[model samples]
Target: MTWSIVARDPETGHLGIAVASRFFAVGAIVPSMRGGIGAIATQAFISPLYGTDGLMLLADGQSPESIIATLTDRDDGCQQRQMHLIDGQGRNAAFTGQKCIDWAGHIIDDDVSVAGNMLVGPNVIAETLRVYKETEGTPLPERLLAAMDAGEAAGGDKRGRQSAALKICRDQDYPWLDIRADDHPDPLGELRRLYAVAQERFLHVVETMPTRANPHGLTDRRLIDEKIAALEAARIADGRPSPSFATPLKPA
Candidate 1:
């Protein structure tokens, strides 16, 4: 049993997904996205092809609705699956198979699509959308965490928690961030800690990594180190504690 959200940040054009489940490593198969194509979450019976093929279809100029129809039409197991997606244009669609376990359904918004099966109740999806809409000014990743937190508070997957994941993609071929708590008593909380760990230095390091537009991106190691140090200093000065999981930077 699982619940997930696939969304496009309208202002940033970033795409991502956040998911929690009783299943192990739900993130590995349920969520998928391409920088500018779109994002998808396929769950319940977990048809991974919906994620891989869905992105391919989204890249091929198919709307989210068309993609869903095509995907479910070709699969005989559609009746047991749960899926939803948002397209490059922000067009959204979802499918909760007729035979999915109880408390299964989806809710679509202007830029988001939320879906779940075997959840505690409709409140799981409802509270997720509510919190997501109310926290619009927050960054995409934080907003996603907030929404997921609300769902958990409202009673998440009826079977209980086992894993969680967060994936974010910016304007590049590679993901900007991808973190998972594959098997944990508190997967979402673990995910939040990892998010804090990423902010400590990893995220800044990502900004300096090579990209298509900047093949030799910020290669001056000393300068990059200076930037990260400066950020850490500023964060400490503001009274925010640094993530303890962050390790000392070793010299090159």
Candidate 2:
């Protein structure tokens, strides 16, 4: 029914998850991460708590192996669930239930983990991990998306695509990027498009967003506008199609 990747950017400590599934709105349910903590993907039986509580456990200094065991120990449905995590220390672990559908399993690589159930075959997760490894120099978000694209090319959910998602968090408590194709014939592609569009304008605006490091953020309108324009120009110079971002709302 689902497969996912949870990873930490070695260069940035940024955490992210990318997932795709035959189920609708899988994004809203599967991925959870906290900056300076770790990430979790809970699918198969889909207990949302594995995501929420799992973060607390990780923050409490629990290892990925201990976190998984604690979560399954409390859930009666563990036999049908699949879960995986990578903690702040780079410790990673994964679980695929005995009752999971065929072709279900997970792989742990340094700084990343890949897991899935009800997929076309083991090649799906394998190729996903392979791509993530091959793209080590790419940004975490793009690397995750690339891995998912490879998984889809290798034949993703046997039943076909429905929803997909990408999430990324830096030092901020909130996500740096959270995009979803909740219900689409080609959800992964849609997520990728949304990511590209974000770079065109939204990501620049985000730079001005108030954060722990920039409590006041950027109040200079000219500076913000210049940054955004520069980003748009860079996109065009790369021979990429430009985005149709709306005019920014006038500050009230």
Candidate 3:
């Protein structure tokens, strides 16, 4: 019913997940992350509690395997559940329950996990990992998107696609970057397009901000001068003339 990837960019320590399913608002249920903590994706007998509870365990210094065991041990429904977890250290773990529907499986790689249940084929998870690893030199979101595209191409959810989502986070004031395309006919493709648009918007905003607020913190004095010049030009264009000074030399 769903396919997902939970991953960390080793170079940047950024955490992210990409997911799609024949389900409504997959973003709301399938992805969860906290800055400087970890990320979780729970689906197929989808246990929403795992998202919060797992993060709490991670916060308490639990390993991914230990956290997974605790959750699976407490739940009688574990056999039908699927989950993927990645810790702050980039340790990854994933599980697909025994009773899940056909073509259900998962792949755990270095700092990443890909999982799916009732998928078109077992190759979905494999292809997801392949794409994630092979698509290098790209931003975290772009790499995640590439993994999602590979899963879709390998035949995603057996039930078909309804919604898709991406979530990424870093250690910043506002670390979450989430995008979703709910109730779309081609949700994965739409998600990819939206991700590209979002990247463009982010770049545009960065380029437009005052230099004093930029990462370099070096003011662009020329830009300020250009703006002042533009304002004066606007006033001149509107036919507003400067006042002239007069002298009284004859009276003197």
Best by TM-score: 1
- Give the local distance difference test score of model 3: 0.83
Clashes by residue pair, model 3: none
Q: Cα miss at 151, model 3 (Å)?
A: 1.0
- Please, what is the TM-score per model? 0.94, 0.92, 0.80
Could you report the Cα RMSD, in angstroms, for every candidate shown? Answer: 1.7, 2.4, 12.1
Which of candidates 2 and 3 is the stronger one according to TM-score? 2
Runs in model 3 lying further than 4 Å from the true structure: 202-252
Candidate 3 positional error at 212, Å: 20
For candidate 1, write residues 1-252 as lDDT tens digits: 999988899998999899999999998989898888889999999899999999999999999889999999999999999999988778999999999999999999999978999999999999999999999989999999999999999999999999999999998868999999999999999999999989877898898888888999887889878987898889979999775665766888
After superposition, the stretches of candidate 2 with alpha carbons farther than 4 Å from their true spots are 233-252
lDDT of 3 by residue, 136-188 (tens): 77988889889888989988997888999998877532345788988898998
TM-score of model 2 relative to the true fold?
0.92
- The lDDT, on a scale of 0 to 1, for candidate 1 is 0.92
Every candidate's lDDT: 0.92, 0.91, 0.83
Order by TM-score, highest first: 1, 2, 3
Q: Please, what are the lDDT tens digits per residue for candidate 2 over residues 1-252?
A: 999999998888999999999999999999999888999999998899999999998989989998899999987889899999998778899999999997899999999999999999999999999999999998888899999999999999999999999999887888889999999999998998899888776777877888988898888879988877787678768887654456755978
